[model samples]
Target: MNFRRLFAVMLKEMRQMRRDRITLAMIVGIPVMQLVLFGYAINLNLRGLSAGIADQAGTAGARALVMDMVATGVIAPTQTVNTPQELMASLRRGEISVGVVIPPDFERRRIDGREAVQVLVDGSDTVVQSAAVQLAQMPLDNSVALANATGAREVTARQIAVVSFYNPERRSAVNIVPGLIGVILTMTMVLFTGVSIVRERERGNMELLIATPVSRSELMIGKVLPYVGIGLVQTTLVLLLGLWLFKVPVRGSVLDVYVAALLLIVANLTLGLMISTKAQSQFQAMQMSFFVFLPSILLSGFMFPFAGMPRVIQWLAEVLPLTHFLRLIRGVMLRGAGLPELWPDVAALIAFTAVMMTLAISRFRKRLD
Candidate 1:
């Protein structure tokens, strides 16, 4: 090893490395992003979850229990409903994550040494379910906290019946298998659509497309529309496999799932069209897809708690279509939720599809540049 030759080669490599700004940025940026997201955004000690309370008990003791729940920063009251049915309605609307249904005889039963209260937890997100279950008992664990806060005798958290509504058994497969539908769709749809235009350009098909009477909007839509059927077949196969192999049940309305699934599929297909327009070559298209794909995997609540992330990170995730679809997939498979309960996710996906379709049509170039 000659010292001079080694130093000269190192200097030449350094100059090339300096010009590769994207690689340098990714090297530094990816790690920093992982650190920040894993540290600040992934919170295990979740607290202050928004909850709806139906204090049918309507007694000083019931009110005190609510206060204790709030003070512990475990379950913050978002709204108070008069009946348990109303509370369930609030939950289905995604208005709240936790529901407390205190029976009218809660106080009487507590004094009589019997179960009197129930906690309904939204089990769509496994992380939220776990935290909510742990905190549902605070009123019982720290009964002393409410000793002076109310006139009725305090009860133990054990007496509080914690019912995880969606994925009741808290099975890992139950939560993950449904979510995989969205993740897999995002990856395949985006990969195919992203490279479609680039592949056409490379094959000299752009000239043929330009000579055709089809407008840019029609052309783009035609390219992506077929994926809708493919997505349906994939969704059915995956769901059937999950049911048979993993014993993951679709407790929700299957019709609702299919409808929502169709909308979600179209939205993602349009997103791929938009990516196709931006990428000039297959390599560039894949690079762009990874930029979207990696974040979708990390921030979409597919792997972590959407509610557990910091407010800003959660807001950032709103732009990713996968984030919304995960909720729909999970809600359908577990919550047995109908369209009324899933309107927000549907609305978001619709908005995404509309915006991306418009953008793709407008940007789609006719020339092979």
Candidate 2:
């Protein structure tokens, strides 16, 4: 047995690993990053969901009912509207998660043991819908006080009328399929383009590319353009399978979905190019892509409720391209939202593409370093 030789080889490998700082850092960084994200960022128990109040009753009792709901910690009333239509409009635009509509005949309905408040929920998100449903079943603590104020001895058992919009059936596929597009594109587009330049350098094509008249911008665009078509094809396949197997309906215009998908594809490709520029080898590029992929899947509302995350984590998630794309795809396919309702997300994707493309181009050099 060659114990001395084995020890010498082990020491040599350790020194080589030390020199490859990126690989060494990733070995430690990936696990720590996952632990922090799963512990602090991923939350299933949703709280403080944004809500709008349509207080047609406009009375002390109506206001008291709102306070009682707020005390449940299920929702935070962030906006007041004149009508249920306005409240629903806000929900359609993804501005609020829950809507409270106090009817004009609130006191009569309460005293007569009829339906009183209408709780409108955005049911596209299963977690938020489940919470809203629970809120509906809960008896408000202030109902007794309001009953006494109206000279009624007892309050009706059913005070809130809960209605779930945008997937009343609450199918998981409706939510998952749309977000799946983003996740798939992020994984493939980033990995494909991430290795492109590195593979060229490894295969000795860099000298040939440098000798050509191709500018850095031209090279970057050329690398990603083919992948854009590939991404759209993948998106189509996913959507078709979702519709055929799961019966997930595309309620909005298909063109809008494609537009969002295109922006996401380009953004991810540019991000990959940026990674390729920084990475010294194909292995390092793949590692970086995996790093980006983990956060995009976990923190981008693909697996968890976006509203459930803490405020700071939500703010950090806003920086990811998949976060905005998920909103756009889900809003279009599930909520029947269009350009008017989803312009903010579209703008965000465009801005992300611009920033990533600029960084990728600036960092990429025409010559081998």
Candidate 3:
């Protein structure tokens, strides 16, 4: 019931938290480090698939098919070889994702109405292969129809250019790395902040902190600052890994990611702080942290594509810090977006942080008695 005693306990808890270096590191350093690694390295869009062709027919008709495939933006034609052996070598060497082997009489058969040319599509990545196969087939079909409609007169093959927009290489790593950053930050900040506060209460040190002259605002800052620093350090380390290992480009301004992540970290920490305010024991806080984490990972578009989810689930995800962070990081990493594009996410986090901190502080009740 004594205000002075409660204040003293808060100060004591602050000192103890400062002394626990590992816990402090997890709170701040981990989130930032994770943001950098997971943000840029993960991508899913496929582009410019390499392909090799073996043109046995050596006729204008076979050449026309190759030309058509090249026109489709999906395949970058590497070499036109005389035999299957040469093209197989290209495929084995990983020079192409697809191999087009034209039989010697391919054009004659098509002209004779025997059968159509066969295309060998690598099925390793069904998504990428299907896209490339579909695009390449367009020229083959056109050539056949043009030849048939013209009635034995040699059809001049049409040269079509396929342009892969956005992510031309279709690498999934680009999407994954950016999204990972948001998830890691959410995990570390929420768990660390909530658990840290609840631990003080469990150890009976909260009473001692409440006894000191340290105000509630000061105590909150003292508890939060160390974790924030840890999150930042984590950000730096992950970014370095992403740059060196994944070869992911930082096309956007570094300050953009930094500002977005900072806001997200603050929101997550504040959410944790709010939960800590409500939890009576460390175990309860841990339970609440897990409760928040499950929904966060599921609803954050990390596992299921956000666009594919039901409208209600998507709406539920809208309020999560991780969801906003994902959009912010992806915009920066993929779109090379600046503050103008990311400001909405930043604003949402700021609003969430403000509300959560206010509620936690108001519920903090300066007097335990």
Overall lDDT per candidate, in order of appearance: 0.80, 0.90, 0.68
Q: Write the per-residue lDDT of candidate 3 for residues 236-303, one digit (tens) a residue.
A: 77777777877655667898888878888889898998888877677667767876786787667675
Give the lowest summed-lDDT range of ten residues in model 3. Answer: 157-166
lDDT of 3: 0.68
Model 2, 28-116: lDDT tens per residue?
Answer: 99989899899999888888999999999988888888888899899998999999999988988898999999999988888887888
- TM-score of every prediction relative to native: 0.88, 0.97, 0.58
Relative to the true structure, candidate 2 reaches a TM of: 0.97
By TM-score, highest first, what's the ranking?
2, 1, 3
The model with the greater TM-score, 2 or 3, is 2
Error of 2 at 183 (Å): 0.6
* Deviation in Å, model 2, residue 342 alpha carbon: 0.9
lDDT-based ranking, best first?
2, 1, 3
- Cα lDDT of model 1 by residue, 4-44, tens digit: 99999999998876876545666687778788878888876
